[model samples]
Target: MPAIVGAVKVINVSASSIFHIGDVYAMAPKSSAKTYAGGGSFNTGSGIHIQLSDSHTYVNDNDKFDQTIIGT
Candidate 1:
């Protein structure tokens, strides 16, 4: 197997509530990273949670959704 190394980063969005696992969310890129605000899938719930390899330097907020809300 290949070796992995370096820092760890994460992005999280909350729906101001609780949810279950295997839920999906539509997240926008953190205001800091140049990543675009597109539709992506997540395994967690309530909000969106993403993990990266390093720290960030910008403000971020995302619009979250589920398969039912956005449609499947």
Candidate 2:
């Protein structure tokens, strides 16, 4: 089956909430990188988590976090 893209919107999590595994997020382009597709949240420590996609390295405070596409 074809993948379905979810609604695009900025991510708004509770103060202590964290994204779960298989959650997808979108990040705007930064520096020399283009728009990125990220997903799969993994908690590292101190309320910080990383996406499982290739754009993980480009994520930053300035980047926009939009959408939460579920499923593979």
Candidate 3:
């Protein structure tokens, strides 16, 4: 069968996430997190340190995978 789509709108899409329209068989999404640290030299013994964090979910694997079963 077929579909008649009209006025399709997509707001936003992020990494490691998927949005399908018609049909999908198999989906395998993998994501990871990483942290970075740094130190700075201060004149006084007491100092405040801050670390910036990353807020992105990147897709590690992009394999669609194999499908065996189908439906109508």
Please, what are the lDDT tens digits per residue for candidate 3 over residues 1-72? 655667879999897687777656787666656444334323256556656464444456556543423231
What ordering of candidates by lDDT runs from best to worst?
A: 3, 2, 1
- What ranking emerges by TM-score with the best candidate at the front? 3, 2, 1
lDDT digits (tens) for residues 1-55 of candidate 2: 4456666565696543454434347633322224645455443568665544454
TM-score list, all predictions: 0.15, 0.16, 0.36
Over the stretch 1-72, how does candidate 1's per-residue lDDT look in tens digits? Answer: 444545644466455333333434653322222333333433557777776656445545564522233221
Quote the positional error of residue 10 for candidate 1 in Å: 0.4
Better of 2 and 3 by TM-score: 3
Report lDDT (Cα) of residue 12, candidate 2: 94
Deviating ranges (above 4 Å) for candidate 1: 13-72
Colliding residue pairs in candidate 2: none
| Alpha-carbon runs more than 4 Å astray in model 2 | 1-3, 20-72
Best by TM-score: 3
**Candidate 3 vs. true structure, TM-score:** 0.36
